[model samples]
Target chain A: MFYREAGQFKSTYQTDQAIFPIVQDRWFMALVFIVAFVVIPLVADEYWHQAIIIPFLILALAAIGLNILTGYAGLVSLGTGAFMAVGAYSTYKMSTAFPDLNIIIIFLLSGVFAAMVGMVFGAPSLRIKGFYLAVATLAAQFFILWVFNKVEWFFNYSPSGTITAPPRELFGVLVTGPEASPVARYYVCLVFLVVFAFAAKNMARGRLGRSWMAIRDMDIAAEIIGIRPLQTKLSAFGISSFYCGVAGALYIFCWLGSAETEAFDILNVSFPVLFMVIIGGLGSVLGAILGAAFITLMPIFLTNAPPMIGIHLAADLQKHIEEIILGLMIITFLIVEPAGFNRLWQIAKEKIRKWPFPY
Target chain B: MSAEPTVGRKIGDVILDVANVSLSFGGVRALNGVSFDVNEGEVRAIIGPNGAGKSSMLNCINGFYKPTEGMITFKGESHHQMETYESASQGIARTFQNIALFKGMTTLDNIMTGRNLQMKKNFLWQALYFGPALKEELENREVVEKVIDFLEIESIRKTVVGRLPYGLQKRVELARALAAEPDMLLLDEPMAGMNHEEKEDMCRYILDVNDEFGTTIVLIEHDMSVVMDISDRVVVLDYGEKIADGTPDEVRANQRVVDAYLGVQHD
Candidate 1:
C-alpha cells in the first residue's frame, strides 16, 4: 500500500515525464537529499568521512564516468585511470599556476583538460571496438602513467615526486590541503558528486545520452539511421573523462591532500572503479554510488570483521582473502545479474508493488 | 510503374543516382557496376537473393560503403564520399534487416535517437537538461510520440526494445527511421521475420508513410508478392550486378531476372 501510486495525477508533460514521477519516489529522493545535505554532516565522525564516505563519493563519480562510456555508449575503456590522472595533474598545474582562483573552479577546469586528452585517446575508438578498443585504452593507461612518472614537470619537479595540494580557502574556511578538516573535504566531494552525478543523469535522459546509447546498441544500424558513430563515441569519452577527471582532482585534493603518482596506479584505481560500474549496474547513476559503497566498505568489513570473529590473521593474508572474496563476488554478480545492483533495486520495487501475490 | 502518378513524378525528379557503382571487400565483389536512380516520391525496391549485393547497394547509397569505383549523386550533389551522419542529415534514414533498435533504450528513447540530427541542443544545455535542451527534447518527444502512435507501439513506448517480440522490434526499427522525417528511407528488410498479420501491418505502415509524407522509400525484400504490390520500380541484382531494372512486372518477366532467381537450366 505504501508503494502504490493510487490516485496521483499528472497535469503536464513535464510532470508526467519527470525523473521521479511517482509521488513516493519524489518524497524518498527528498528525504535522501535532506539526510545527505544536513543530517549526516552534523552527526558523522572524522573516521567515517575520511576512511569510507570520501572514497565512496570519489569512486562513485569515477564509476559514473565509466558507466557513461561502457554502460551507455558501449565503449569499453581501461583508460579511466589515465583520464583521472590528467585531472589530478591538471588540478595540480592549474592550482599552482593560478592560486587566486577557487579550488572548485580549478577542479572543473581540470576535468576539461582531462576531457580533451580523453577525446584524443578516444579517436581510435571510432575504428576499433570491444576487446581491441579495451587494449587500445590500456595503452593510454600505461602511456599516461609513464608520462607522469618520467615528466617531472607534471609533479612540479618536487624532490619526492609527490604532488601536494596546498590548503585553499572558501568563504574564509579551508577546503583543501593538509590544513583542511575531513568534514570540509567530505563536503567538497559530496557537493561535486551530487552536482556532477545529477548532470550525468540529466545527460543520460536527453538527446546526447540517446545518441550514446544509439551507438552502443548497433553501430552499423546507428550509422545508417544517421547517428554519427565517431561523434557519439567521442562525446561519450569526453564526458566520461570529464567526470573521471573531476573525481581524480577530488581524490587528490580533498581525500589524500598529498598523493604520489603511484596513487593513481592503473591496477589499484582503474580496475576497482570499473568493477564498481559492473557491480553497481551499467548505465544507472544510483548504481554507481551504491557500488562505490559496496567496494569502499567491503574491504574494511572483511579485514576487521574476520579479526572480530576470532579468526585473527596477518594483514597480508587478510588482503589476499579479501581479494578472493571480492573477485568471486564480482564473478557471481556478473553471472547472476548483469544488470547489477540497479536491477536488484528494480526487482525489489516491483515485488513491493505486487505484494501478497506471486505474479 | 506504368500509371502510378503519385510516384514517378516527372523525368527530372531523380532524388538518388548511382552511376557505374561497384563495391568489393578484398577478393569478394559485393556489387559490380550497379547503376540506378531513385525518383522522388516512389517505393524503389532493390530485391535479390542472399549475397546478391542488395544490402551493399543500400549501404553505398547511405554512405556506409564507399564504392570501389563509381559515382553516387544525391539531390543534385555529387560527392565521392560523405559521412553516414552527413547523408542522414541530408535527409536519408534507414532501418536494418537485423533490427537495430538501441537495446538499452526505451522505444521512446530509440525513436528520439532517430531525431538526433534535428535535436540541436548544445553540450552545456544538454548536460543540465534544462532550458533549450529540455525544450528541444520535449519538442522531439512529441515527434517520437507521433511515430510511436503511427506504428501502434504506444503500449511499449516506455519498454526497453530488447525485450520486445521480434515483430514489434522490427516495427520499432521502422518507427525509429520514420521519426527522422527522412526524405529518403532505406529499409534493408522491413518484413523479414514477420508472420502474415505482422507483414500485413508493416506493409500498411510502409504504404502509409510513402503516401502521407511522400518519403522516397528504398526497400530490400525477398517477398515477390509484397514487392509487386508496393514498389513503383524495382532494381534486381544477381551475382554483384544489376540483372534487371523496370516495373515489378517487367522485372518479373525479364529473362535475366528469371534466370537469376531460378538459376540457369544445366540439363
Candidate 2:
C-alpha cells in the first residue's frame, strides 16, 4: 500500500523526467544508500567483505558495461574478459610508470585505453550483425588475450607471465596491494560502483540511450531517422569498454590483489559477466547489479550450504552440480522471463502499487 | 469537404523536384524515368496499383535506394544520389510502409528520438545528466509533449509502440516523423490497414500537420477517396512509369490513369 503513487502529480517535465519520479522511490534509494555505506560496513564480517561483497560490486560494474553494449545497444560482445585485461594490464603499467599518481586517475585513464581498443574491435560491427558479430567479438576475446600473453612489455617482463597490481593509495588511504584492508578496498569498489551506476542510469535515460536503443531495435529505421549508425555503435563499444576496463582494474587492485591472464579467461570472466547480464536483466542498471549479486553469491552458497547441512559432497562434484544448476536457471529464465530478474522486480512493484486488491 | 479556406495558407515554390529518376534491381526495373515536383505547403499524393513502383519512388526520394539515373533536387540542391541519413540532416523525414518504429521503446521515447538532431548536449553532459543536460532534456520533452498533445496520443505516451494496436503504432510513427520538425514529410501507406474511423483520424492529423506546420507532404496512399479529397495534386504511376500528373480531379479524369486502375481493352 505504501508503494502507491496516487497522490503525486508532476507539475513540470523536470520532475516527471527525474530518474526516480515517485517520492517513494527516492526515499527507498536514500535508505539503500545508508545501508550500503553505513550499515553494511558496521555489521558485515571481513569474509563477507573480502569473499563476497567486494567481488560482487566489481563484477556488477562489468555487467553494467556489457549491458550497455549488448543490452541497450543491441551489439553482442564476448570479449569482456579481454577488455578487463586491457584495464588491468594498463593500470599495472601506469601505476609502475607513475608511482606518485593517484589510483583513481589511473583507473579513469586505464578505462580510456580500453575504450580505444574496444572501438578498434567494434569496427567490424558496422559490416556484421548478430551471430556473425558475436564471432567477430569472440575473435577479439582470443586475439586480445593472446597479445597480452605473448607481449613481455604488457607484464613488465615478469617471469611469471602475469601482471601484478602494485600497491596504490587514494587520498592517503592504502586501497591496493597485500597490505590494504578488506574494508578499504570495499570502500573503493563501492565508490566506483555508486558513481558509475548513477552515470550509467543517466546515460540510459537520455538522448544517447535512445539512440542506442534505436540502433538495437531497427537499424534501417534508425539510419533513415538520422542516427549515425557507426558513431552510435562505436560509442556503445567505447563506453561499455570503459566501464569494463575500470571494473577490471578494480578486480585486480581492489579485490584479487594479484592476477594472471587466466583470471580473465573467457570461461572465468566473460561468460559469468554475460550470464549476470542475462539473468539480472538487460537494459537496466539496477538489473546489472542484481545479476552480479546473484551470480557471485550462488557459487558461495552451493559450497557452503550442503556442508552446513551435514551432507558434504566432494568439491569437484559440488562444482559440477553448481554449473548444472546455473545452466538450468539460464534456460528457464530465457524461456520464462527473458527480461531477467529486473522484470520480476518490476512486476512485484506493479503488484505493490495495486496492493490489497487485484484488478 | 469542410469549408476551410486557404487564404492564410500559402503554397510556395517547388521544394522537391525529381527529374528523370530510374531505379533498377539486377535486371528488373522498379521505377523508369518518373519525374514529379512538390510545392511547399501542399499535400501531394502518389497512387498506383500493386507493383506499380509507388513505394520505390518514395525510397528513391528519401535516399534509401539510389536511382540508377537522374537527379533529385531538394531546396535547389541537386544530387545524383543521396545518402540515407542525409535526408534527415537536410530536413526530410519519413514513415515506412511496414511501420518501422523502435518497438522496445515507449511512444514518448520513440518521438523524443525524433528530436535527437535538435538536442545539443554532448555525451559527457548526457552521462552527468544534470545541470545543462537535464535542462536540455526537459526543453525537448516539452516539445515532444506538444506533439503528443497535437496527435492526441497523450494517453498512450508511456505505452510501448510494440504492444499498441496497428493504427496507434502508425500514429506513433507519424508523431516520430513530426518530432523532427521536417521541411518535408514522406508517408508510405499511412492508412493502409486502418478502419474507416482510424483512416478519418489519420487524414485529419495529416491535414492538420500540413496546415499548421506548413510541412510539404509527399504521400503514397491506396485509398482513392482520401487521395482525391486531401491531396492538392496527384501523380499516377503504372508498371515503372509515370502515367499521369495533375490536380486530383484532372488525374481522376485522365484516360491513361483510368486504364491503369481499371483494365484497358486489348487492341
Candidate 3:
C-alpha cells in the first residue's frame, strides 16, 4: 500500500545510481521544489521570507557542510565558524576589490579561499584523532575569527570594524545589500542552495564518498586497503569548508546584508551547525535540512510559550530557557537515537513498507 | 581436495626475495635476520610458535613496519622503503590476523572499496557519477560480485560486516582482499579461530585462488595440518629466525623443525 520498488528495474548504472531511486521519491522531490520555488515565493509574507525561509536555507547549507566532515568523514570538526569567517571575509574582499564581478562568482571564489584555509587547519588530523582533532579545529574557529576582527583591510578600513555587503545586481535586479527585496534575496539563496545541495548529494554517493566512509569506519584498514588518509581527510575538509564558505557569503549578502566578526562566533555558528548535523543525522543530506528546520523552528516555540502562558520573563531569562530546552532536547534525541532523525526516517519507511504486518 | 590445479603458470622461479629483514620496537627485537623467498604460483607458509614474528614479517613485506635492517625485493625490484598504500598499489594485498574490514559499511561497499586502486574516475567525474564514472563503477561492481559468489557469500552481500559472525567476517575479509585482483596475496592467520569446517572451507578457497588465478601467496598459519596439507614450501621460524625451509614433508622430518615448531621433547 505504501512506497515500493517491486516493479522498478535498473537497466543501467546511471539509472541505478539516481539520487531519487524510487518513482515516489522523484515525485516527492518535485513537489518540494515546486512548493519552494513557485508557491512559497508567491504566497509567503516578508516575515516568512526574511525570518524563516531564507535563514532556514542558509543554515541548512551550513549544517550540510559540517555533516560532511563529522558525519561522513568521521572527523569531528569545530572549525565551521572559522571557515565561514574565511568565506565571508573573502567575499567582502573580492566584491570590494573588483566592484564589477557578479555576486554569485564572488560567493564561489570565497568558498575556494575558505577551502584552502580548511585544508591548512585539517592538516593536524593526520596525526591526531577524535577529541584532539576537535580541539584543533576549535583553535581554528577562534584564530580565524580573531584574524577577521583585527585585520583592518578586511572591513575596508571602516571605523566600525563591520563589513556591509555592498549593493549587487543579478539581471538588473538588486539581489544583495539592504536595497534587495526579501523575494530577490530568497531566490538567490534558493538557486545556490539547490546547486550546492545537488553537488553535495552526488559527491557523497560516489568514489570520493566511499573513500570518506572507508576512512570513517577504520583509518588503519583504510590505509592498508590503499586509501590515502591525507588526501581523503583533506578533501572532506575542503568540500565541507567550501559549502560553509558559500553559505557564509549568502548569509552576509542575501540575508544579513552586513555582518561583524561576532556573527561568526564559535558559540553561535560552530555549535549550532554541529547540533544541526547531530539532530538531523550525520552523513545525510536530508538530515541536514531536517535538522536546520528543527533548530530554527524550536526557538520560536520556546520563547513564545512563556508569553502565551501569561508569564512575561526578562529577555535574558527567555534566552536561558531556549538554551536549556535545546540542550535537553538534543540530549534526549541523542539518547533515544544516536543516528538521529535520518535513522528515524528510515525506520518509519520500513514500518510503512510492512504496514498491518509484524515488523 | 576438490581444487583443480592452477590454470596459468603453475609455479615459477622466485617472485619475492626477503633477505635478512630484521624489525625492532624500541628495545625489543621482533625479528632478526629473517630470510626467505617464494616462487610464483606457490602457496608458501610461514609457521611459528607464538611471538615468533610471523605477523611482523608480513608487515615488513607490505611496508606497514619498516625493517630496522635488511631488504625485500618483489618482482626483482628492491624496496628501500615503501608506504602501505604504495605496497597495495604494487599488487601486494593482505588480510589481517585480526579482521580489518570496514565494519560500518556493507559487505558490498567493503568489496567495492577493494576496487579503489583500479577505478580511475577523477574527483570531478566521481562528483557527477553519471557518465564514465558510472560505467567504471558498474564494471568493478561486477568483478566484486563474482568474488562474493566464489566465497559463497551472496546472501550476506548487503549485510553490514560488523553484525556478521566471526567466520563470515573472515571470509568477507578474504573476499575483499581477493577482489583487488592482485598478483600476490598475504594472509595473516586466515584460518585463525575458525572451527574445523570453516578452516577446511578457507583452505579450499586459498588453494583454488592460487590454482585458478596463479596468485603468489605467503600465509602465516598456526594449524599444522592445514599448513602441511596446502603449502608447497614451508619456512619455519623460531624466535624470529629461520630454522628450517623445505617441502612440507622434509620440514616435518627435520629434528630442528620438530623441536622448535612442533615442540617435541627429545630424550
Candidate 4:
C-alpha cells in the first residue's frame, strides 16, 4: 500500500524520466543509502566489515559490470574474472610505478585497461553469438590470467608470483595494506560501489542502455535502425570491463589485500561473479547487488547455521554441499524465473501497488 | 481515384530508383531483374505471390540484402547496395514482415531506440546522465511520445512489446518506424494477419502517415483490396520478375497480373 504512485504525478519529461519516478521508491532508496553509509559504518565490527560487507560491495560492482554485457547487451561472457584481474594487475603496476599518485586514480585507470582488453574479446560477438561468444570470452579468461601468471612485469617481478597491495592513504586515512583498519577499507569500498552503481544505473537508463537492449533483443533490427552493432557491443564490453576492473582493484586493495592468479581462476572469481550476476538478475543494477549479497552470505550462513543446529559436518563436505545447493538454486531460479531476483522484486512491487485487493 | 486529396502535398520526382535489380542466394534466386521507382510523397505498393520476392525487394531497398546485379539510386546517389546504417542515416526506415521490436523493453523504449541516429551525446555524458545527456534524452522522448500519441498507444506505453497482442504489436512496430521520422518507409506486409478492424486501422494510419508527413511509402501486401485502396501505384512481381507496374486500376486490368494472381494454365 505504501508503494503507491497515485498522487505523485510527473509534471514534465524530466520528472517522468527520473530513475525513481515514484516518491516512495526515492524515499526507500534514501533509507538504503542512510543505512549503508551511516548505520553500517557506525556499528559493524571488523569481521562483518572484512568478511561480508566489503566483499559484497566489490562483488556487486563486478556483477553489475557483467550484467551490462551479458544481461543488457546480450553478450555471454565467461571472462569476468580475467577482466577483474586486468583491473587488479594494472592497478598494481600503476600504484607500484607511481607510489605518490592517488590509489583511487590508479583504480579508475586500471578499469580503462580492462575496457580495452574487453573490447578486443568482444569483437568476436559481431560474427558469433550465444555459446560461441561465451567460448570467446572463456579464451579471454584463460589468456588474461595466463599472461598475469607468466609475466613478471605484471606482478612487479615479485619472487612469490603474488602481488600485494601496498599501503595507501585516502585523505590521510589508511585504506589499504596490512596497517589499514577494516572500517577504513569498508568506507572506501562502499563509496566506490555507490558511485559506480549510480553511474551504471544512469548509463543503463539512457541512450547507451537503449542501444545495448536493442542489440540484445534484436540485433538485426538494431542495425537496421542505425545502431552500429560493433560499436554498441564493444561499448558494452568496455564499460562492463571497466566496472569489473574497478571491482578487481577493490577486490585486491580493499578486500583481499593480496592476490595471486589462483584467486582469479575460472572456478574462483569468474564462476562466482557469474553466479552473482545470474542470481541477482540480469540487466538490473539492483539485481547485481542483491545477487552478490545472496551469494556472499549463503556460504557464511551454511558454515555457521549448521553448528547451531548440532549438525556437525566436515569442512570439505560443507564445501561440497554449498556447491550442490548453489547449483540446485541456479537451476530452480532458471526454471521458475529466468529474470531472477529483479523480476521477483518487480512482481512484489506491482503486488504492493494493488494490495488489500486483487487486481 | 485517390481517396485523399493532394492539397499542400504534390507527388514530386522519383526519390528511390531500383534499376534492373537481381539478388541471388547461391544458385537460388530471390529477386531477378526487378526494377521499380517510388515517387516522392506517393504510396507505392509491391504485390506478389508468396515466393515472388516481395520481402527481398524491400530488404534490397533498405540495404538488408545486396542485389547481385543492378544499381539502386536514392536521392540521386547510386550504389550496388546500401549499407544498413548508411540507409538509416539517409532517412530510410522500414518495418519487418514479422514484428521485430525489442521484446524485453517497454513500448516507449522500443520507439525511443528509433532515435538512435539522432542521439549524439557521448558515453561520458550518458554515464553521468546529466546536462546534455538528460536534455537530449528528454528531447528525443518528446519526439517518441508524439509517435506513441499518433499511433494511439498511450495506454500501453509502459507495457512490454512481447506481451502485447498481435495487432498492437504491429502498431507498436509502426510507432518505432515512425519514430525515426524517415523520408521514406518500406513496410513489408504491414496488414498481414490483422483482423478486418485492425487492417482498417492500419490502412488509415498508413494513409495518414503519407498524407501528413509526405513520406514516400513502398509496401508489400497480399490483400488485393488494401493494395487497390491506398496505393498510388502498384508493382506486381511473379517468380522474382516484375510483371506489372502502374496505378492499381491499370495493374488490376493487366492480363499478366491476372495470370500471376489467378494462376493461368501452362501448355
What TM-score, over all chains together, does every model reach? 0.94, 0.98, 0.95, 0.98
Predicted candidate 4 versus true structure: per-residue lDDT over B62-139, tens digit per residue: 898989999898999898966777788988999999999999999999999999899999889998999999899999
Runs in model 2 with CA error above 4 Å? B2-5, B262-267
- Encode model 1's per-residue lDDT on B1-267: one tens digit a residue: 223545524323899999999898999999899999999888889988789999888888888888889999989899777777678888988888887778888888888888888888777898887888888888888888888888899899889888999999999888988999998999988899788888888888988888788888999998778888888899999889998899877887788877778354321
| lDDT tens digits by residue: candidate 2, A218-304 | 998998899999999999999999999999999998888888888999999999999999899988899999999999998888778
TM-score of chain B of each: 0.93, 0.96, 0.95, 0.96
* Candidate 3 per-residue lDDT over residues B73-177, each given as its tens digit: 999989957887888788888999999988878898898888899888876787666679878888998898789989999999878899999999999999989
Worst 10 residues of 4 chain B by lDDT: B258-267
DockQ of 1: 0.71
In candidate 4, list every pair of residues with a backbone clash: none
Q: Write the per-residue lDDT of candidate 4 for residues A73-155, one digit (tens) a residue.
A: 98889999999999999999999999999999999999999999999988988999999989999999999899999989999
CA error at residue B189 for candidate 3, angstroms = 1.3
**Which 10 consecutive residues of model 2 chain A have the lowest summed lDDT?**
A162-171
Report the lDDT of model 2 for residue B174: 98
Q: Relative to the true structure, how large is the alpha-carbon lDDT of every model?
A: 0.87, 0.92, 0.89, 0.91
Q: Arrange candidates, best DockQ first.
A: 4, 2, 1, 3
Point out the higher-scoring one by DockQ: 1 or 3: 1
Residue pairs with backbone atoms closer than 3 Å in model 1 (clashes): none
Candidate 2: pairs in clash: none
Off by over 4 Å in 1: A307-316, B1-12, B262-267
DockQ, per model, reads 0.71, 0.85, 0.64, 0.85
Candidate that scores best on lDDT: 2
Residue-level lDDT of model 2, residues B222-260, one tens digit each, is: 888888888998999999999999988788778998888
Docking class of 1: medium
